[model samples]
Target: MDIFERKPVNHAIHTSPSNDLRLVESAIPDIQPHECLIHVRATGICGSDVHFWKHGHIGDMVVTGDNGLGHESAGVVLKVGADVTKFKPGDRVALECGIPCSKPTCYFCRTGQYNACPDVVFFSTPPHHGTLRRYHAHPEAWLHHLPDNLSFEEGSLLEPLTVALAGIDRSGLRLADPIVICGAGPIGLVTLLAANAAGAEPIVITDLDEGRLAKAKELVPRVRPVKAALGEDAKGFAGRIVSELGQEAKLVMECTGVEASIHAGIYSARFGGSVFVIGVGKDMLTFPFMHLSSREIDLRFQYRYHDIYPKSISVAAAGLVDLKPLVSHRFQLEDGIKAFETASNPASKAIKVQIVDE
Candidate 1:
């Protein structure tokens, strides 16, 4: 241990049973041989975090008292344990949210599908505390050193960026492919960037919120933006997308987990085209599965991500995509409650609310 180590006190933002967030001080963690302690600098509030705050659960992950809430994070290393060679104190880094079982016998790990490992432990999900804290200790293997070109806020975005990349990767999108992306949330916006990076052109992006669509257009002027009217059914939106783009898109990446949006993406894809679903929504959705067979529309689902941190970092460092526009709001560590309040309110026009430790 460094003789001059800072006093081992940490503060974490966690949710209570009443769906309110509170900050509490706790002991800083001791690093394992393969781990490092990070002084968290920035973390973005994800849609799933909002779900957990509003409903106290997402899927099966419940936010009990002990559950700290945040997963997207970046920080500076405070300490590195013995035997750790990849990083040391003062290194800036981004955290990969999922930690999988390292056991070689684990089927998913051996198959290079570690994200699907049955015994995986993900941050801010149910029993696991997350990265919304003053300090955190994480495995060195899961941490990616951030280059000087990327800000801490941009580094935190790598988690969502990887999701967008995974969607494109899953779709097997070809260059210049006509694509439609539903939901102009963070994931959708990043998907637009990923598509642009992949050489996809004349992409159409749809959103119920005209503000979000306008923001998307501002970011990517070449994108075709379509605003879905209120009460517009999936079929109706599909027709609008076809009319806007002059033909069904070759691929539709559904970033909104809403049932109607999912249906629209599926219905809007060209015959034999693929639809990649990247959002997390309700478990059961009423869908016309039979239509898929007649049109040969390939429906693919994506989980979090695989080994994509390095690529995401490189993409940001190269300036291929600018992620700074997505962060429309920022809050200090002391303003935890207000931060969640603003993030949960659509009226706030908050695209991505970041909590920063000053």
Candidate 2:
């Protein structure tokens, strides 16, 4: 071995049944010929992480044991297997959680859309562990080398930024497309950033929480923020958005999985426009099929992401968008339990809570 892998135990945070999370030590993972070991520097707590911690599963992936729970992460290279040439020890890199099977026979992989590969093993998604630990091992190809200008915190945020970029790309947004985003949370905020970068103008964002709406306006001053009133009908909500923007939106990005928000996005869109859904909602949603079909609205969906890390990193490096303000809270690895608690509850007003190595 070229590098001395001396650590015998790695302390990691895991989620168990009954909303339990604890810090425990386990043996450091071994690196394969094409893999590299990373000493985790920072990991961001995601909404999915909170869902898994509270319910022990997000749909079908249950936390049977002390399952790790994080995917948005960045760290330094600790060791690299013999065949790893892209990175070496002390290199800084951001981790991409999903490892898709790149076999040529797989249709998705054959078309360079590996994010849709059914055989992908994404971190923190059942049976597979995540990067919210002292050390992690990943295939070299999935990691993106971070520039010296990007801090570990900024690097951790690239995951969600890539998601936003992927959503915008999938939506096929055109220049100056009037867009409405249905939520002002992390995903929605990042989507706004992506839209603005893509030349989408006069964007409108909605959320029930006034604070989030305010934060959205603060982050992107040009974005028109609207607060969703309680029990507001889709038509009424859409009317408010249209009235605010002075015209019906050409693109509606549904970042909230709430069925009502989805409906609002549909109705807010202009005739023959598109509604891109980025949030993962229920398996089955009862939508206004007749209305959407009659209006000829294009309903699109964006999965996690595909081949966007490089572009996302490049954009972030170039200051095309400022993501640093999105990180609202921070906790050490040992205080991960508190991190989860804060993320689960909205009292902390946390847009993105990051966990740093102690």
Candidate 3:
């Protein structure tokens, strides 16, 4: 062990079914041989984290036990396994939120569909702990090294960026394809960038938050933002799209996961266009499938990524996408609870909140 090895410490946050939250310090997790210990440098609190805090259980999988939840993360390599060769101490890296089963024959595992692996362990979800700690340990292969130019905060976002990449990749987006992205949250903006990178000619975004909508416009000026209000009817959504862009979009990537937004994306997509569902909302949504079918809309689901980290890093490094602008709030490792609460608040106008380990 390194003479300066920091002792692992525990920290936790609890979320009630109705959205109440509490912060506490607990015990540290152990590092296994195939794993590496990472002193988390920065982690972004995802919408799912807020959902768990607010709704307790999303669908059938409820977080019945105590666990650290922040998953969109970046950290420094504190210790590497004896046989590890890809990385070493001091390497800045990002952690993929999901952990797949090691068993190769598990259908999804054998097909590189690890995200669907039945035995996968993920942070803050039930029995599995998370990286929101003084130290976190995970298998070495799951870690992705970050470039020198990317800040820890930006590095922590590889997960979201990769999600955007996967969405665009699956959409079969090509040069000059126009896109309409619903919801201008971090994922929405990231998906816009992914679409922009994939040669999608015109990228339009829709959101209820004007500030977030503006940020999306500022970052990617070509990305037109359609501001709307939260309402039961689709009038706000439909009016904004028609007035702003003047035509139906060929691609609609739904990042909001809200029932209304999902319906809007389904309606907005032109005939034979695609809709990539990148956000997580109610598991069961009431839908008008006949209309979507008539439009020949191809609905795609965005799960956690497979092997897009290296490309995400490269895209950030190449300046094809610079995510630093999205991170508007930050906190130290000791103040994770406060960070998550801030992240959960829509009024905070928060884009991204990072937990700094240092």
lDDT of 3: 0.79
Task: Please rank every candidate by TM-score, starting with the best.
Answer: 1, 2, 3
Residue pairs with clashing backbones, model 1? none
- In Å, residue 22's CA in model 1 sits off its true spot by 1.3
Error of 1 at 76 (Å): 0.6
Which consecutive 10 residues in model 2 have the weakest lDDT in total? Answer: 1-10
Error of 2 at 341 (Å): 0.6
Indicate the residue-level lDDT of 100 in model 2: 94
Q: lDDT at 286 for candidate 2?
A: 94
For model 2, residues 1-358, the per-residue Cα lDDT tens digits are: 4333544458788877767788888778889999999988999998888888877776666878768889999999989999999998999999999999999899999998898898999999877888998889999999999999998999999999999999888888999989999999999999888898889989999999999999898888999998998799889998999999889989999998889999999999888999999887876789899989999999988889889999999999999988899988899888888888888788888899999973
Cα lDDT tens digits for candidate 3, 158-189: 77898888777777888988788899998998
Model 2 Cα displacement at 82 (Å)?
Answer: 0.6
Count clashing residue pairs per candidate: 0, 0, 0
By lDDT, rank the candidates, best first.
2, 1, 3
Model 1 residue 35 CA deviation (Å) reads 0.7
